[model samples]
Target: MSTRNSLRSAFLQLKRRSSTNTGGVWSDFSKRPTTLKINNAPIRQTLFSEGNSEEGPASLTNGDERLAYHSPIAIDETFQMAYRILEKEANSKYQIVDRLEKSLKNAASQEETIEIKDRIDKNLIEAEIENPEVLYNAEFADSKLLDKSQPVYRHLLKEKWENYDLLVTMQRLEQLHVIPDTLPTLVPKADVKVKFTHNTEDQFSKWVTPGSLLPAFAVSEPPTVYIQEFDRVEGSNNLYTVLLVNPDTPDLATNSFTTTLHYGLKNVMLNNVDNSIDVSKLLKVGPRITFKEYTPLTPEKNAPAQRACLWVFRQSKEIGDISEASENFDIREFAATHGLTPIGAHIWRQKFDRSVPGVRQMYGLGEGRVYEKVRSMDPLNL
Candidate 1:
C-alpha cells in the first residue's frame, strides 16, 4: 500500500478510539508522544525522595513544598436538578407561543415561509417531550451525535436559556465540593540551548501558554449522489485549527507565534463547533514530530527551554499519501449536507502542506502552561 494510505488508516483508528471513550479529555492535553512512567516505589518515599536515599531524617519535614496545586473536586449536584427544572419551565407552551408570535411579526422573508417556520419552531418547543415521529420531527437535545437524517436540537432553549440566574447558580455550585484536579507544573527554568532560533529564549517564552483546539482533520466530503445523506445536525462549520501553545510565557511573547502561525494560512480545516459533542474537522496527527529540550543556560544568563522539534518529514503511508490517506476519515456526510461536492486526496496533500504550523523550534515548559483560562464545571453539566 502507498505511504499515505497507511497514515490515513491510523487516523481512522484514533477517531474510533476517541468516539469510543466516553470521558471528554479535560479542556486541554499534550502534544508530546505517549510514554509510560514507572511508579513501583513506595508512595511516601517516591514522592518525598531527596535523591540521597538516606533513612528518614528526625526533624526535616516537607508538605506544601511538594508542588501541589488544587482545584474544586467535590462537585455540587443540586445545581443539575435545579437547572433541569428551570429549563423545563422556560420551555413551556405559553412561552413558546409568545416567542414565535413575536418572531413571526418580525421576519423579513416571504410571509408564508416565515409563518411556517415560526409555527414549526413554536410547535417544536411545545411538543418536544413527544417521541420522534416521521420525516418532520424536531430534535430537542444539545447533541448532533445522531444520524445525519436526524435533525439538530434547538428550540425555546436558545432564546430563553440566557438568564444570569443560571450563571449565578453555576458559580455557587463550584463551592459545593472540593474537586481538585492536579497536573505537573512547568520547570522553573530550563538550562538548554535551542539551535533553531536567532534567540532561543525569545521563542521558548511562547510555548508555555495553552489555548483552544487540537490538531485534527477530517476527509473532505464525498460527492453527493442520488439520495444524499440528510444532516440531522445543522449550523456546524467545516473548518478548524488547534493551537498547542503553553500558557506560562508572557502573553506578548506568544503574540508573534500566534499571528505567524495563522496569518493568511490556507487549506487547513476548522471543526464544526455548532451542535455536536464530537471533535469536528480534526486532522489526524502522524508520527512526524517530536519534542527536544536544550541542555542549560547559566551564569550571566540562566535559562530553561522546551522547544517543539520536528524529527520526521514524511508521515507513515498508512493507506496512501496525505489525501488518499485521509479518505479513511469520516468528514464527507456532513460536507454533502451543504450541497458541495466531496474533495479527494490530491487536494488533501496540498492541505497538509499548507496548514501545519512551523514548530521547528517551539520552546516552553510544555503542557503545564495553559492553567488559568479553562472554564470550570457547569453545574448543569454535573
Candidate 2:
C-alpha cells in the first residue's frame, strides 16, 4: 500500500475508536494503558492557611461548614513532596527507598497517624507496581495479535497512545506477503534506517569486528570485539562480533546485533602478526551489546565493556533509531538465525509481560515503588 494511504487508513481506523489531538495514529499503536483496579491514593492536605482555597465558596455562611473537616495533624511538606516522587516510579524499587527516605523528618509527634499511613502506603504501592502487567514488553504484546483485549492491539484505538517505538503487528503481518516461513520485518524499511558513523577526529571507525566465537559463546547476549581489518596481516577476513543490552532504563527495551565477524577466516595463519586485514567483501558496523548484567552496586560482573563481543546480523546498516535503521533492517533473517519463531499478537502479549524483567538490578524493591508512584501521579513527566 502507498505510505500515505496506509497511514491514512491507520489513522482513520484509529480515529473510529479514539479521539486524539495530534500524532493520533502512532499513539494508538504503542500505548500502554494501566488497569485501574485499586483507586485510593491519599492526597495529603496542607496545613490551614489564610484565604485558603480549601475553605470552599466565599458565599458560605460558615467557614468550617463550607469545607469538610480535616484532622489536626500537620502534613510534612518535604516528606509529602518526597512521597510524590516515590509513588511516581513505584515500579523502580532501587529508587523508591531513596526517594521515600528523602521525605522523612528527623523527628515527628507520636500522634501522627496519617504520617505513619504514608509509610505503609509505600509498601502497598510497591506490590502493585511489581506486577508484569504494568509494563509493556514487545515480545508479549506481539504474541497477542489476535486477542482484541491486549492493549498494544487495543491501544491502536486510544487517542493519547501515540508514541510506539516498536513496529505494529498489522504492518508486520503484511510483511509476510513477501517471504514464506521467514522472519517478518518488524518495521517498514522506509521508516527506520541504520548506518555507520566514523569518529571525525579519530578517522578510524569505533565499530568492532570479531576474532572468534569464543567471545560470543561466553553469554546469551553479545560481547565487545576490538579488531580492525585495514591494519591487519594478509589472508585475514576482517570481521567482528557486536552485541547489545536492554540498558535497563524504565520503559525502554533494547535489542542489538553486530555487522560481521568472520575475521581472518579465509586462510590459516600459523602465527599472529601486526598488519592491516582488508575488508573487501564485508560490512563494518559499530554496535553496543549487553554482556553480563551485574548487581546495581557491584559493577564488576555485568557492566559491559566496550570493544567486547562481535556477532553477525542478517544484514548490517548504519547506526540510528528505528526511522534511520529501518531501511536496512532485516528482522525476518535475524529471527531465523536467532531461533525466534513466528508468533501472533495474542501469544506475544503474554510473552512481552512475562519477560519484562520486573525486578532487574537497575530497578529493585525501593526504586520500583518510587517509579510507580511518580508514574501514577505524573505520567507525562516520565
Top TM-score model? 1
Write down the TM-score for model 2.
0.17
For all candidates in order, the CA lDDT equals 0.24, 0.27
| TM-scores for all predictions | 0.21, 0.17
RMSD of each: 26.1, 28.1
Off by over 4 Å in 2: 1-163, 168-181, 184-193, 196-382
Error of 1 at 189 (Å): 41
User: Per-residue lDDT tens digits of candidate 2, residues 246-334?
Assistant: 11123311222222111111111111122121222122311222122211111122222212111222122222222213223343454
Residue 66 in model 1: lDDT: 35
Alpha carbon deviation, residue 18, candidate 2 (Å): 42
Candidate 1: C-alpha lDDT: 0.24
lDDT of 1 by residue, 40-73 (tens): 2333222222222232221235544333322122
